[model samples]
Target: MRMPAAKKVKSLPPADVEAIFARFHEIEPEPKGELDYVNAFTLLVAVVLSAQATDAGVNKATKRLFQLAPSPAAMAALGVEGIEAEIKTIGLFRNKAKNVFALSQQLLERHGGEVPADRGSLEALPGVGRKTANVVLNIWFKQPTIAVDTHLFRVGNRTGLAVADNPLAVEQILLKVVPERFMLHAHHWLILHGRYICKARRPECWRCPIREWCRYEPKTPAPNGA
Candidate 1:
């Protein structure tokens, strides 16, 4: 589901855009994603499994699985059934298992058992899309790329940050508007804000660090009683 039309806000002024990220940086100089992974391969697998599931859920299933198959060759050897058994707790386990196995084999055969550092090669792997590739590229390779997820889609339009109909458009706008200094951690900051304070259903505007810059109106009230 999408944010309601009633909540959509107009684009924020250029200064407010900068102020918002400045406030984010003031609060968290170094924002981090919730997903846990050891290496680039594990990060890729985690992102793949995290498509429609929560990071906590994916991490729970992959805790043992990653340990069992930390590399492409090891994961390929596990086969689809083995991977499926390990990740069965996640949603769409069957399809995700096949993807993980196939992608692992592809990595072994194509990139010599190393996760490619480029977008084209990474996106070629099974179940790896632009967003997944961008995540791996940004986090693993230190590229200043934005990987827009649902939280981004909502927060972008709802707060007049990017105000776009789709994720890519929002990403592009953010890339242009957000200052270079904050590009590296922009996605993490925005996603975490949307996940926590600037929530989808009931935005806790009273506590939002940058609510002053956000366009979404009718700030949510604090709960009754302390």
Candidate 2:
């Protein structure tokens, strides 16, 4: 559902972005990724499935599938057909299934069935992109990497905190502007905020925590028809 449109978040200067991060650290302290997974391998798979899909959707699909194929060996054993049957509901399920199976085999052969911690190795795997690699690096390895997905792209652009055209540009801007202390949890905070509050549709300004810092158009009507 589209949220009520929010006023543009105030364009944050570099110092202002730093200050905002400081406040976020005080409030949430330790934000984490919303996608649920049992291990690094599972996290990687879940992220691959999450492209153009919601974490909730990926989690739902993985909840049962992961239990069945928790490891690379197990997933490879399942084969493409088995994996496809399991994840058929997700968009581009056929291709994703193929990638999942191929990646599982590659994992076993290349990394002893373990999900590699390094971004380069992770990117070498099928279906894993920079965003997926960044997510795995950040959530599983606790690296301070930003994975700018659509939510983040919108949040960054709409808020004017880190305006950019593509995810890569946004990622670069965020890395530069977001405070060091808030780097680890920055993805979660921005994603959650974008998902629930600063949505693409109308934003819910009344309950917004950072509405005061925003620069978008107000959702509420003026007191008088001026």
> Which one wins on lDDT?
1
- Stretches of candidate 1 off by over 4 Å are 1-7
Tens-digit lDDT track of model 1 for 1-226: 2434434579998899889999999999988888889999999999999998999999999999999999999999999999999999999999999999999999988899999999999989999998999899999999999988888888898889898877778899999999999999999899998899877778888888888888887878888872
lDDT of each: 0.90, 0.82
What TM-score does structure 1 among the candidates reach?
Answer: 0.96
Write one digit per residue (lDDT tens) for candidate 2, span 1-226.
Answer: 1222323444577776776667667778888777888988898999999887888888888888999999999999999999998898899999999999999999999999899989899999999999899999999899999988777777787767776566787799899888787899998888878888776765666666666565556553323442
Worst 10 residues of 1 by lDDT: 1-10
Candidate that would win on TM-score = 1
Model 1 Cα displacement at 28 (Å)?
1.1
